[model samples]
Target: MKTPLSRLGNSGLETSLLGLGTVKFGRNAGVKYPSAFELPDDKSLASLLSLAADLGINVLDTAPAYGSSEERLGQLLKGQRHDWIISTKTGETFDGKNSAFDFSAEATRQSVERSLKRLKTDYLDIVMVHSDGNDLELIERNEVIATLDQLKQEGKIRQTGFSGKTLEGALAALKQVDMLMLTYNLREHREGEAIDQANHLGKGVYIKKAFASGHLVSGSGEEGQLSSFRHILGKAGISSIIVGTINPDHLKQNVRALCQASAGMV
Candidate 1:
């Protein structure tokens, strides 16, 4: 059976319960994964994406900070642009060794424009602020959110959101953006209240680090994954869990776990 889809808040978008994260697709440096690995070749990525589609995965999460991910996705996904919903980030950029942040309206607009060109799309399904752990200050400034609103009006982005580390920032973002991405998994449930609030307000919530940065996935087994998935996705407000993996078998395993999780929910 295919993975089920649900309303991502009220943005008029429906996303699979599992979203493919493209961080490993673009960059492997300065990451927090359990192990280090080489970047997959183009042929490998193509096959992985093909498998993702076969498994009914529709959402692709990428970021400008993720090295060449946006450009590569633009090339890899050419001609099938409308088939997948692409979510990219702004407000942060990585230069192999370090990352920088600039949330001025000018910088955010430039970032979105560059993302459109890199993704080879005229508009984005979702664009989020790549918070630099300074979520509260950024949200208070309102520069990034304002630019995203202008882009939405100009048909450059379908929805605006924030991927932040702090609860304070998450709550503030929930009030303004159509979507929210926060770290929520079996190990960490600090963002639970924010998830409920976002759901109550009819806003979409996307989960990050659901597998605890792959720490929990190592020896958990499928049954363990099913339990974790149920715990994370069982919440009322979670729109999807963003998992980044280049392994085809792992992808299929996640989908299977998701299907089982959904069944358990019913």
Candidate 2:
């Protein structure tokens, strides 16, 4: 099957409509709350990433908060750097033991430098401010925006964005961002207002938590809930929906959901 790709905001970077999320690579989000469908080891991760690139999945989202996900992804995709698009986050620094949220200019700069080292890349396709709602204002402050702009100018980051929990928080930084990653799924639809605002501003919208953290896929409730959710979001004009799973079967199932939802449209 041919995967569809779309331009991110006004940037030249084009990504698959369904991106691979790397939150489960290194961290154990607990045994009860699995990060993705299948938790592959280092070897498996490398193979899966290579397969994803062959399948034309360009965008891969990761963060420092997701355990050693960024580092693992970097190592796995080391030789295949130019084969895919890498999207990562900053605003928080982790040193294996401690994590401190710092949106200051100096911190942001340091964060990107660390991310670059971890990803084994000179420049990132997109760098998002991973703010947890409370730091929305700090993300929008001149220092933060100026730092991101500088990174773009320096060719260290192609574009800048943010991941917010609320529509208001996303909107607060819309003017300074080229993309917005937020939760918009079947069970959680409150982000529609912010998505509309982002679209109007010509910002790319990358939907996260699209299945409500795997609730729709577990089959504990409605049977066609996942399909319905994808259909609704596709009709609503969302650019992409990221569904991650470590299990290949489950990953294919998620792709099936997307296929069924957009059967006629695509």
Candidate 3:
């Protein structure tokens, strides 16, 4: 069966229930430990994206903070841009030297413009306010929301969201965001109530670290532990789970687990 595509809040954009995270594509920084998987350059990245598209995964999530990920995705997916739903983030500036938060209205506008140039797209399906689970006050400020609203009007972003680490941040953002991205695996269900609230409000919810930073997946030293956690998320009402892997076989395995979870076979 074809995977279902659902609307994000009242936005006209529809995305698959699963998304691909590109945080590892261009660079790896701030991660607690270095990844053993060989990082893909431009060509390999394109091939992987093509594979993902063939597998019925439509939503691709990337960010400026992810090294050269956004630029690489732009170069690789330029031809197939219309074939997928592309979601990216803003609210921060990266100079290859240091990164700093900038949620002001002007900064947000400039960020989206830069994203458009980097993605080589006229518009984005969704643009999230990239947050580190802190900065509640900045996120709630009228300037940021107003700028996002303006971008929505200009057709630069179809919908806006916030990627938060805390339930309180998510809750505070629910009033203005069309969707939310959070860490919501079996072990991190502290946002259960927030997920319920979003679902009730008809806002889309996207899960990150669903595998607990590869802990739930096999070969990460934590196997068989994910089944129960997967069960919990499937039953708890999550919209989509974004997991990253470098191996094609492992990607297929992840998809299988997702299929099983969707079929209530987990």
Candidate 4:
């Protein structure tokens, strides 16, 4: 089944209900997923993207901290740029062995510029500030949101947002940006109120770690995955759920699960 598109709040952008997360595409050294894995080769990566596109999944999430993900996608999606909605992050960088964050206005600008070159795109659909658990501090101390806003105005990015961890940070981000990428899975729901608020305000809310970072899987197999998808995607506030599974079969299962989950809701 093909994933359907939905309006991303008031950003005037439309993305699929399921977004493919690309962390495993570039960095696997210090990830927090269930297990360590190897990065896909160019051919495998191209195949995965092709399957996603054929399934009608439009959004792809990447970040500077995700190592070479942006560059690889830039190369693979060369002639198919318009086929996907690219969502990447700023404020964090990975140097193969470690991650360093800089939320300064200058850094934010430089990060977006670098991402543009790496992704081989003239304008990004959405640019989110990757929070390091210090959501509020990142917004107030640095030019993270402001720089994104400027970029939006300059037409470099269509929208600005924050992938925050705390409720307060999410709320603050709601007031200043077009979207909020928050963690709201079976294991955590503290951001529930924030999600509702974003819905009411017409701001996009994309869910991260909807399966609790791969720890919420149950013996129900595909049914378990469908349940998790229903729990979050069934909510009216969510724009999309970002799942990072490199295995094509897993990706197909996720899309099918989402289809079943949404179907059951009706």
Candidate 5:
């Protein structure tokens, strides 16, 4: 069965309950997955995306920090562009093994433009700030939210938000943007209050690290995986849970889990 699509808060974007994260499509250098692996070749990535589409996933989450992920998606999703909701980020970049941050208004605008060029799209569906732990400072001091708002006004992005690390930041961001992406998983529920607040305000919420950053995934059995997914996706405010993978089997399994969890909801 195909996974169901839902309105992402009040952003007017319809996305699958499960969104595909594209970090593995472009980088694996500084990740903390249980094991180190080579980046998937183009052929493999194409197959993975095909499977995702077949399973009814419509959101693809990427960022400038994810190495060449945006570039690869631009190339591979050219003909199928209209079929997916492309979400990328600004404010951060990955240099093979280390990461860097820039939240200046100029850098934020430049990042969006660069992402547009790399994704081969004239406009992005969503562009979020990829925060480096200074979520509040980035918004209040650096004016990242204002910059994204300006870009949205300029027709460069359809929706805007931040992948915030702090609850205070997420809450503050909810008042300013159309969406908020945060870490929420079985192991961590600190963002639950923030999610509820976003939902109350009719703003979109995207869940990241639902599998505990791969540590729980590595340790969990099949039943354990199902329980974790059910708990996470059962929450009310989540527009989608973003999971990154280049493996077809994992993608299929994730879709199945989402289907099962959703069934329980209905």
Candidate 6:
């Protein structure tokens, strides 16, 4: 069965119930996955993208902190750019060794421009602020959000979002941005307030870490994954869950779990 689609609030963006996270496309260092793996080759990534499309997954979440993800997507996603809803971010970048954050207006603008070039797109569907745990500071920074607002006005970006760590910042972001990217799973619901607020306010909500960085789903097998998917999707305000996987077989199984979960819920 095909995955279901949801309107990302009033942002004019529609996404699948499951979105692809591209961290594995570029960088594997400093990640929290249960296992480490090599970066996928172009052919491997091409097959994965094709598989994602076939499985009805349309949303992709990436960031500068994700190493070369944006650039790889730019080249790999070249001919089929319009077919997917590209979601990227500013404020943070990951060198092979360390990460850096810059939410200034100049850096933010430069980041978005660089992302556009790296992603090889004229207009980005969604651009979010990649937080560095200082959620409140970034939300209230004014310069960053204001810069995003300006970019949206100029048609460089269609929607703005915040991938933050704190509930306070997430809640505040709903008032300012088009959507909120959060970490929500059976083990973590601290952002419940922000999720509820986004629902009430008609803002989009995207979930990360729903699989506990792959520990939750992979160990439990298909039934375990189904349970995890059901648990997250069962939540009221969730627009999509971003799951990162480099294995094609795992992607197929994940989508199957989602299909089964949705069916059972009905």
The TM-score obtained by model 1 is 0.97
Q: What is the C-alpha lDDT of each candidate?
A: 0.89, 0.73, 0.72, 0.88, 0.86, 0.88
The regions of model 4 sitting more than 4 angstroms off are 218-220, 264-266
User: What TM-score does candidate 3 get on C-alpha atoms?
Assistant: 0.89
Candidate 6, poorest ten consecutive residues by summed lDDT: 257-266
List model 3 lDDT by residue over 1-266, tens digit each: 33444455445566666678887886665553234554676677777777777777888888887778788888888678898777788876556566788788887888888889998999988888888546477776637767888899988888788887788888888888888887777677776677888878888777787777776555553344347335545544455667766556656566655565556431
| Cα lDDT of model 1 by residue, 1-266, tens digit | 56768668877788888899999998999999999999999999999998988888898899999998999999999999999989999999999999999999999999999999999999999999999998889888858998999999999999998999988889988888989999988889887888999999999888888888789889878876788788987688678788999999889999988998987462
Model 5 spans with C-alpha error above 4 angstroms? 264-266
Instruction: Quote the RMSD, in angstroms, for model 4.
Output: 1.3
Give the worst 10-residue stretch by lDDT in candidate 2: 29-38
lDDT of 5 by residue, 1-266 (tens): 68777778987888898999888888889887889999888899898899899999999999999889999999999889989999999999989988889999899989999999999988899999898887777788897789999999999899997898988888887888889899988788887888889888888888888787677777565565578778876678678889888878888888787888878573
Model 2, span 179-203: residue lDDT tens: 8888877677776777888767767
Scanning candidate 4 in windows of ten residues, the lowest lDDT window is 211-220
What is the alpha-carbon lDDT of model 4 when measured against the actual structure? 0.88
Worst 10 residues of 3 by lDDT: 220-229
Off by over 4 Å in 6: 264-266
Error of 3 at 241 (Å): 1.2
**What's the distance in Å from true for residue 229, model 4?**
0.8
Candidate 2 residue runs with Cα over 4 Å from true position: 29-39, 94-99, 140-142, 220-225, 228-232, 235-237
Candidate 3: C-alpha RMSD to true structure equals 2.7
